[model samples]
Target: MNKTKNYDLTIIIPMYNEYENMERLEKKLTGYINKARMKTCVLLVNDGSTDGSLGRIKDICERNTDFFYISYDSNRGLSTALNAGIDNTESRYLGYMDADMQTDAEDFDLLLQHIGSNQIVTGIRARRKDTGFKRMQSKIANSFRRRMTGDTATDTGCPLKVMWTEYARRIQFFDGMHRFLPALFSLEGANFKEVPVRHYPRTAGKSKYHLWNRLRKPFADCIAFRWMKNRYIRYEINEKEL
Candidate 1:
């Protein structure tokens, strides 16, 4: 078992080749966590970045009281990074965001305020800031995903999300699982809600995902998601004695 934590929220940031943005990312994230109404801390998962990102991440974690970090050997996809963060964290509530400051960390407070009675609270990317091609790909992918999975998530790929630690740990992840969080959580029979959040364009580094990797790969993974959905198990013990 991992050590338990008393913090109200833990923010998990999965970073890959984001050295240029680490300085601003850490400063903004730390500020938000520190000033948030609830006590919060940041956990950065460095996904084997070849750039100087790892060193920068280490420096931030060491110098900042509210920041911690972990690193993997080779580059893993976003889903894997998120899973690693969830597995390592000890907080009661876990929130996820990308290393890019596209989504403001301050918006976390809005979601956190209404987390009551819901196991998962996610953000809807309001006025999404993305390239034209990226926006087109997202629209196509999201349409197919909603029709196939019936997840009803307007923006499943939104970077800002919060969930109960227990429910988050129970999720099954795949390569494209990052885009299907709402569906997966629903499969676990947990309640969820979404609120609009601000979005901004990348200020540093480049996006790791492209059209094929973002759209085509996810289309294939949707089949895997479907299989998991059909076979998912849930139960309630009316009476238990241990």
Candidate 2:
């Protein structure tokens, strides 16, 4: 049986080829968890990094307090990592962030403040520190996605996010689900809040996304999301017998 945690929240960080960011990630997260408002723990989900990051993640988790890790033998991409994290989370609330060091871990307190009666709380990266071309591409993609999914997410790709574990586990798993989490959560009639969070330029590690995958892939996934929206099931029982 999966061991259920007594912590108030579990933060799940998914990593791929993030060997260079591991040291800074540990420093940042360790400092954040020490002062966070809730009793928080971190779970590092390694999606089969070939850059020796898997070993580094193991090492950090061993030394850091309330840090745990799980890894895949092969690279399975972001969606798989998220699903696995949800499946293993042993807490009432599950938060998510990237290992790229682009977003601040401290802003989790801001997101947590608004999670009351909300199934999900996500971040909007304020003053994004990216190339103009990269920003433009993301803006276009987010606009297209909002039109397709009818969700009011300002930045669906922002890696900082928090959600109730029950609602997160209810999400329908799909190949590109990470890009459509807000829409999928809403499809289940769950409430979510979006808060602005800090963004920073990456100091290390190469980004895994490129023009083709960032733009074209999400476009296709939006269509898939539309199809799922049409067939999604919802139900309510007025009463149940013991």
Best by lDDT: 2
Could you say which candidate leads in TM-score? 2
Quote model 2's TM-score. Answer: 0.97
Tens-digit per-residue lDDT, 9-56, candidate 2? 999999899999989999989999899999999999999899999899
Q: At residue 112, give the lDDT of candidate 2.
A: 97
lDDT of 1 at 148: 84
Q: Give the range where candidate 2 is weakest over 10 consecutive residues by summed lDDT.
A: 1-10
Error of 2 at 227 (Å): 0.6
lDDT of each: 0.88, 0.91
TM-score of each: 0.96, 0.97
In model 2, pairs of residues that clash are none
Residue pairs in steric clash, candidate 1? none
Q: Tens-digit lDDT track for model 1 on 136-196?
A: 8999999999988988888888999989999888887777788899899999898889999
Output the lDDT of residue 188, model 2: 83
Worst window of 10 by summed lDDT in candidate 1: 1-10
